[model samples]
Target: MLEFKVNSQSQSVDVDPTTPLLWVLRDNLGLTGTKFGCGMAQCGACTVHMDGMPMRSCSLPVSVVAGKQITTIEGLQSKTAQAVQKAWVDLDVVQCGYCQSGQIMSAVALLESKPKPSDEDIDQAMGGNICRCATYVRIRAAIHAAAAQLSA
Candidate 1:
């Protein structure tokens, strides 16, 4: 049995050590908010927070995160996360909604690290996350709005 903390809850699952954390989260833990985009980690749809850092869950092994903190979209309750979510909604940033969770996760991480990120910083931080709807402009705007809200 492998033990780990997920969304502030202690969990134990019996699975292969090499099993991707995406499956472990979606299938085993029923946290489907962390999507499966490119299984090779090219897409950021499977983004999640490991010890407060955004990571691609699709390519990560479950065993590697043992005893570590894993926070999914459903459990993202930080002030930064709230600000990001509010900005995303207030700015109408969702297209198909398939990739919003990952996008929000990445945005929250970026804001937490850099509360006042410039356009270049946002571009650099969000480079790995692909939004098929091409809502890059809206996303950037939301990030800025969220930062502003946090600053206030």
Candidate 2:
């Protein structure tokens, strides 16, 4: 049995220790917003916040994250997350929308850590997330917009 806090809720699961947190969140907990893009963590589609820091859930073992605070896209309730979401919507940042959740998660992490991230900082922070629709321009715009909104 493993015990952890997911989205501010206490959760316990009896499963393989090495099971990736993505499966546990999607299959066991019904939190499917954290997508599975690349199982190898090359893509950031499975990004989620572990203890307020962005982490790739697809490659993280559930046992390793036990007792940690996990926050998925579905549970993103921070003011920064709200700003990011609003900015994404305002700028229409999503194309295919398959990877927006992860993008937003990464963006939120970036903004939380660095309130005013430069282009290089955004690029370095969001370098791993792959979007097939090539909406990188809009994503960066939205992050900047969100930062502006937060500053207000």
Candidate 3:
């Protein structure tokens, strides 16, 4: 049995220690918001916050997350996350919307760390996430807007 905290709740799960967190979240915990883009860590679709830092859940082992705070899109309900979501919607940042959750989560993490991120910072932080529809322009704008909103 492995113990972990998710979305402020403590949970105990019995499963393979090496199993990816994505499957445990979706299959066991029924938190399906975290998606699976690439089985490898190449794609950021499975990004989640482990102890408040962006992490690729697809490559993170369940054992690694044990006793740690794991937050998925479902848990992003703070003022910061709300501001980011509002800004994303205001700017219409999503195209296909497949990767928006991860994108938003990543942006929230970024803004939390760097209140005013430059283009280079945004690029460096968000480089791992891929949007097939190529909504990068809107994403950057939304992040800036979200920062402004958070500042207010």
lDDT (Cα, 0-100) at 85 in candidate 2? 98
Per-residue lDDT over 1-152 for candidate 1, one digit per residue giving the tens place of the 0 to 100 score: 99999999999999999999999999999999999998998879999999999999999999999999999999999999999999999999998998888999999999999999999999999999999999999999999999999999
Q: Estimate the overall C-alpha local distance difference test score of candidate 1.
A: 0.96
Q: Residues 45-124, candidate 2, lDDT per residue (tens digit)?
A: 99999999999999999999889999999999999999999999999888889998899999999999999999999999
In candidate 3, what are the lDDT values of residues 30-82, reduced to their tens digit? 99999999889887899999999999999999999988999999999888899
**C-alpha TM-scores of all predictions:** 0.99, 0.99, 0.98
Which segments of model 3 are wrong by more than 4 Å?
none
Q: Against the true structure, candidate 3 has what lDDT?
A: 0.93
**Local distance difference test, each candidate:** 0.96, 0.95, 0.93
Candidate 3 Cα RMSD after full superposition onto the native fold (Å): 0.6
lDDT of 2 at 87: 95
